[model samples]
Target chain A: MYDTNYHRASSVEEAVKLRSSQDEARYLSGGMTLIATMKQRLAAPSDLVDLRHVASMKGISVEGRKVRIGAGTTHAEVASSSALKSVCPAICHLAGMIGDPHVRHMGTIGGSVANNDPAADYPSAVLALNATVVTDRREIVADDYFQGMFDTALEEGELITAITFEAPEKAGYAKFPNPASRYALTGVFVAKGASGVRVAVTGAGSNGVFRATDIEIALSASWSSDFVASVAVDAGQLMEDMHATPEYRANLVKVMAKRAVAMAG
Target chain B: MAKVTLTVNGRTMSGECDDRTLLVHFIRDKLGLTGTHVGCDTTQCGACVVHMDGKSVKSCSILAVQAAGSSVTTIEGIASQGELHPVQAAFNQHHGLQCGFCTPGMVMTAVDMINRHGGQLDEVTVRHELEGNICRCTGYHNIVKAVLSANEEMHGASRQAAE
Candidate 1:
């Protein structure tokens, strides 16, 4: 909580300029995470360029197999969007499951993905559905976008305008959330498309959200709950905390994956 | 310092505060509306729940500057004139409060829930929707009954008005 300046950015380019020109500027979306961090003095930026006012970054559009969601669209909007629900109910369900109603009303998908928290819900969706992160600069595939927990391929001052992805044939998300905060303790998102199956695990990875290759391969071959349940996720690289052990998290990954498959079916 | 102007309980109020001032502080300290409590500033507790632009949000988690030009409603605004809102009346009838620390927030959250769900909420939906608002004293037994009764009251009132 330092003395900081707040600038309302009207457009994406203006937001970029506002952030890039400042000595230490942060882009503010929903401010669900950033504001909390700043309040805790964990982050002290000289300026915050508010992107919520930017009209271009607010919507959910679906066309054919393609679904493009504006980064600033709040989780509540996504959860309640009828157009998005018709095309991708799993996404709506995931959005609905994030935090509580108040948090969902304020938190945005763009903010969730940009922060790249290890336990965030959207990263698992983006990674599992093979979505693309569309920034003001360029498009980055979901696979290449996330690097590690709290890490992403986004360069400094870059603004994420929107995220685009082809709707999977079938997808479902399941998570064992931390009871107090409602953040994913261990979550699994499963998607089946023409390209086969993709499984992404979040909240358990020490390196952040990662693809469960074994689960993906098993589901690709069988596309059955039993197959996914039988697939073992390696606990070696998982994060161990007061909430769960590495081994327990690995088990959660498998169980969640199986549940996700069943739910998708 | 940041100068923010927001409509609180239908009053357009202006205030000056630090850029880091939370909306809860702005509403309570700056505007002098003490109904919104700050139980946990970490956003875990829903004690600071308020409606910003017709949507329920955690006032403690949002900055006053961020809420510039927005319309906010706190627990102080819940009662119209002197009459208690349907939810408030139901809370009283069902004995929904014990310590009353979380009442303001729970009432606000309940109003928002009824706003979205049309007051036809069942027990399961009420419990699920009440996930954000925690009541330590009531054991949630009376609180759930209050919400259901409030929903019924609201539904009957609306239905009667229509007729």
Candidate 2:
């Protein structure tokens, strides 16, 4: 489906240049999503900018209490990284649980977050962690980055370089995956940061992943499962689908939230 | 078409192909390695799993051109000099395959898991790690068994080699 001429970018600058020059140029990370979309005739780009060889686009580093993951880092790399596992086991666990072993090996954090599929696992984790996404042009907080489902604040030719997330005191992510698609039916990431407790829910909401303000407020005060149960999320903000109704999602948000809180403890 | 070079199995090969051609197609069609199968048009199926630069990946979801300058190990590349790779031997001994369509992909994925996790194979980890490769046959009972067996064999080999 991709009839485009391929350009193997040896550096980030070349990739950005190639992306900026073409109207339909796309950055190819692991190609887990882009290649499949191309095979299905869903996306046909005019130029494919290969980012795998860009030397500076891979690694894991810890600066202060934050973990910085390069955009080109694969799910498998993150899942198995000693540094990430030692500091943030929750993130490693979530990375290992994405799709499967093969997908984890090939799929990348940048691609997953960039695609921002409602069912994806990373957005909620990044959102709850209050991560900062460093792009070619600017740095955007997770809250301001994700505009909606499959939408981001990225401008044309913008490419995410790295994502840095503050280490949480205690954090957990629980996802009820769609049996067939392996996408999230309702996923919740609960984190106890230095500021306060943050709760982000994905898959059940039409706006993709978003902070559960009521639950966050309650949890921030008490940081307990019982407190989380008392705060109800309105069903109006939930997404309805063949797998689950909006009311069911509303109910799941409460249950998953409680489970996440219990897990975080 | 682009002149692409990569090491497959242990040998380096160079080929010319369209930039959009998928690695699975190149391996199956151009190279005539049919052990890798395409079960789904989408990236969902791990049936086309292979090792790219020592990590298992869904070959169907990666372009041939992207694989240029990287090392690739397909199902055909795993077994060397007529000796079956440990994962393949385990699959054979355990009767891990039913229709055998997903065997290559399953073996490729199993080897990768063993490489990462070593010999500590639990039912949960095996099931979770095998999420990418789907087997409609054997109910996945033997597939998990094969991975465990491969893990044991590799661990034994490592110990023996170290001794």
Candidate 3:
């Protein structure tokens, strides 16, 4: 890894101040992806503003149906959170399935969402659950937050403080993970709430996590596993790699959607 | 250079390293504790697993400065009074290792897994929890056995003490 300056920020204001002071500074949450990327020489920032110690950005609070998860909250914490599980177990189950125990220990929801890795688990949950991305500056709805794979609407020097969403009445997630890397080959999250039925697909989308409006429409009409399975996912917009063909990924979208619907039931 | 101070193996140690120096390198080169192995510099392999503030994490992916003021436990810290930890003893008794490259990380991960899951671990649960720790030798059959047996022994002992 290239030489860089590391500064630990104790508060959101300090974190933003420290980041702006350096020309090429990146906010370091869990460093699960950033550190690994830096080690590979793929990214080399001049400075890193560590946000793991920020007191206000590290917890899960649930009030009625609204759930707020601090950006600094680790995946492990999310997976074990009984409060979150009680309201929306699908997110907890999804959190538990990310990487392995060690990776989950250090990876954070904010970092994962901020990175917006196409294959990441949180983006699907964020999008499907209709969560709001609360930054240090303002709140952005999920639809506007995710721009594309590894891209977000977050401006330069902006920091995500928390994510808030109303717990869906029924929700479930299913992923077909790559055997070696454990990233989702294709993952689907299905949720039914006041906003109506929403289906989000991750890992397969060439443009990143996206709403499967067709599947959502089908589920909204029937709300059954059979209906989800019958919805054909178009392969044109899906990504194809060594692990799977676009057609296969398209099929996985339906299969995972079906499974998620079953799980929700 | 960055000055990082942290408690490792119950010893408060401080060292100066490059800001980018990984926690595994700090533990190995600076502190002279080489028990924590770095199998894959990439995060995929679990050969560099260690307990940071009592939770298992990939040491290779964490910078030394990021760990300052945190309590870390390496493979070298698990034994008590020259006696092997129950997990280590179980690994020895169950032939959980061959070539031994991944043992430190495997052992560390297993200790953490047992701590969290307790003695009621089943085969499937142990295998799932060992996902981060990769064992190229013995096909992980013996490693899984060692972890399960160690869980039983440790939990049984704790239960007896409570009784």
Best by TM-score: 3
- TM-score of candidate 3 against the unseen true structure: 0.99
Q: Evaluate model 1: give its TM-score.
A: 0.98
In the predicted model 1, the residue pairs found to clash are none
The C-alpha stretches of model 1 lying farther than 4 A from their native spots are none
Q: Is the docking of candidate 1 incorrect, acceptable, medium or high quality?
A: high
Top lDDT hit: 3
The CAPRI quality class of candidate 3 comes to: high
**lDDT score at residue B140, model 3, on the 0-100 scale:** 96
- In candidate 2, what are the lDDT values of residues B1-163, reduced to their tens digit? 8877888888888777898888888888888889889998587778999899998888888888888878999888877789999899999999999999988889998988898776677889889778777888789999998899889899878978989
Candidate 3 CA-lDDT value: 0.94
Please, what are the lDDT tens digits per residue for candidate 2 over residues A1-265? Answer: 7577899898888899999899988888888778878888899999989888876878999866789999999998888888887777778877877887777877889888888998899999889999999988899999899899999998888998899888899888888888877788998889998857888898988989899989889987888889977886899989998999999988888888888777776
Tens digits of lDDT, candidate 1, A28-147: 899889988988899999999999999999999999989999999999999999999887899999999999999999899999999999999999999999999999999999999999
Please, what are the lDDT tens digits per residue for candidate 3 over residues A108-197? 999999999999999999999999999999999999989998999999999999999999999999999998888999999999998999
Model 1 chain A weakest lDDT span, ten residues long: A227-236
Share of native C-alpha contacts between chains A and B (below 8 angstroms) recovered by candidate 3? 0.95
DockQ of each: 0.84, 0.82, 0.92
lDDT score for residue A146 of model 3: 92
User: Which one is best on DockQ?
Assistant: 3
Sorting all predicted structures by lDDT, with the top scorer first, yields: 3, 1, 2
